[model samples]
Target: MQLPAKGTPPPARDASGLATLLRTAGATDTVLAATGGWLLSERRSSPATQDGYIRDVSWWLWWIQARGMDLTDVSFIEADTYAAAMRHAGLAPGTRRRRLSACSSWYAYLQRADAAVRNPFHRMDLPKRASKPSRYLTEAQLDDLVMHAVAHQSARTAAIVAVLKATACRISELTGVQLAALGHAGDHWILTLTAKGGRPHRVVIDDDVTGPLLDAYLAERGSAPGPLFATRTGARLQRSYVQELLQRLASSAGIPDPHTLTPHAIRHSVATALLRAGEPLDVVQALLGHADPRTTQAYLHVDQLERSPAHRAGRRLAAVVARRLHSRTGTREPRPADIAQAT
Candidate 1:
């Protein structure tokens, strides 16, 4: 079987394309098609996730076909060899893990259907990932960024930054926000977001900051029922546009590595700030709309370092040292000889 060109897009999400690919790879077309159908039918699977899984599987099939091996004949040895090939290709750890997971899931589905003898990935061990802390802007930096956006950019841009910082919503969720989804309950403003996996959550807006910006933006936008954030022509904003806007704002604000400033980084900044303020993990989890408490716990690790007694003591000691140096250089009592001469 001949593989697609190196840079060709993966097979489309359709029965005919899937069947053709499976047949070309010498895979069980009926079983693989059933698995694909099941994945598409999964209520929790987002479009991105479905597309990713399909791409991963397509790559796996190509790899097997190129080696003159059939997918149905794969074994634990082939799985291990695939892992080695991935490592040899210098794939990032996260990418390797996700790709392996996609293959594993397909094999598991086949096993359950009695179409395969064993799951090739059942006992395979992938490389362990290092725990890296999430990067976020400091409060001062955030303030500066927001101030710059407000002063130099449009009202809508400022409002977008404010909402992201305060609510920690994903960029997709933010773009999906409709004008009608915003409401006021007593002293608080609420935003209803349909997050990943189609989960709907309501979060309060920080009235002191985001509220005024939102009000100003809405006034500029006039009454609209479409996207909460839109262009002058009322077209919905794209995620890439928001990202570029943020990068520009960060650069204008003198933030280091401004290009790395993304909506998720702002979201992480919010979580870190909340955790440092001693907000409970469960509360922060709910606020971030994290499906798992463990995902929220990553922020706690960073908070622990920031709030550690040693870190606080070090800051205090540094301040004391600075004061002592200042006193010795400028505030010490005049030397006796110098004072006598002056007298």
Candidate 2:
């Protein structure tokens, strides 16, 4: 098939049209054509996801054409070489990984359909990303944020912040929450969130602050079965709108770098608070609804622990050990003053 120009846009969202376009462009492999169609037609995939997959796959096709190879001719070595080329071309590590993942998904689909003999990406190793410290607000900063939202912004904004910090839920989860999903257990309220992969998990709003704030927001929203957080027009709040609201609140609160104060940052603050309070990793994993414990472990921060009781205890123990050694040896560890005096 004749490949499109190097910078051409990806195929449109119509699955059948996309398949026809691939076939007309000289993609003679039946499996390759079918995989492209399947990707476009997958019910779980959003339009944005479809566009991303198409772009990534289009880049792969262009690469194969440039190298005088066919889609079905890609071997493990070719796949590895493509990754190496991406790296040498100065693509970011995350971008390279995403592109490789898109290719791997296509191959996996082909394998499921018995269109390919083997998956070339089966043995491909992804680059390890350096873990950065999770950005979060101090407890005082968080309190200031909430106070600003409550006083300056609307009740909806305050409730949004409260729910995010209390539940440590993703923004998507918060926006998707339905009023019907919220339930009261005696004195406290519980939120049933459909997290990533449509997995439903329940979290309790046991704190007095969150529960009262949520109650005020709900009272303003009225007894409705729609989204827990909706606009004046009764439409569910969009993710971007929520992000902008948080930024505005952060600015009003006098927080530095207001742009960095996001829903995820609030979630990070909650996770760090829990971990520093001696919450078990497994408990945090369950609360965050992480399928893997390692994912939850990433939210744990050592720096946040500096002000905790356990950290103070550790410092006290070290001091005690030093004093014991001094008494036993009849020689204290020399201070900078003692060294200077001796010199």
The C-alpha stretches of model 1 lying farther than 4 A from their native spots are 1-20, 26-29, 41-44, 175-189, 206-208, 211-241, 307-343
- Residue 163's lDDT within candidate 2 is 82
Clashing pairs in 1: none
Write model 1 residue lDDT over 76-173, tens digit each, in one string: 88888887787776677887787788888887877777777777888689777856655688777888988898899888899999999888899988
- The predictions' CA RMSDs to the true structure, in order, are 6.4, 7.2
> lDDT tens digits, residues 1-343, model 2?
2334334565533455546545644665767556756565643244445656776766676666577765665699888888888777667787778878878888777777766666778758987674666568877888888888888878888888888877889887888788899997787678998866556788999567888998888888899679889888778888788888888888878998998777888888888778878899999888898889988887765555565899788566666666665766666764544433433
Instruction: In angstroms, give how far residue 65 of model 2 lies from its true place.
Output: 8.0
For model 2 the TM-score comes to 0.69
Q: What is the lDDT of candidate 2?
A: 0.75
Weakest 10 consecutive residues of candidate 1 by summed lDDT:
334-343
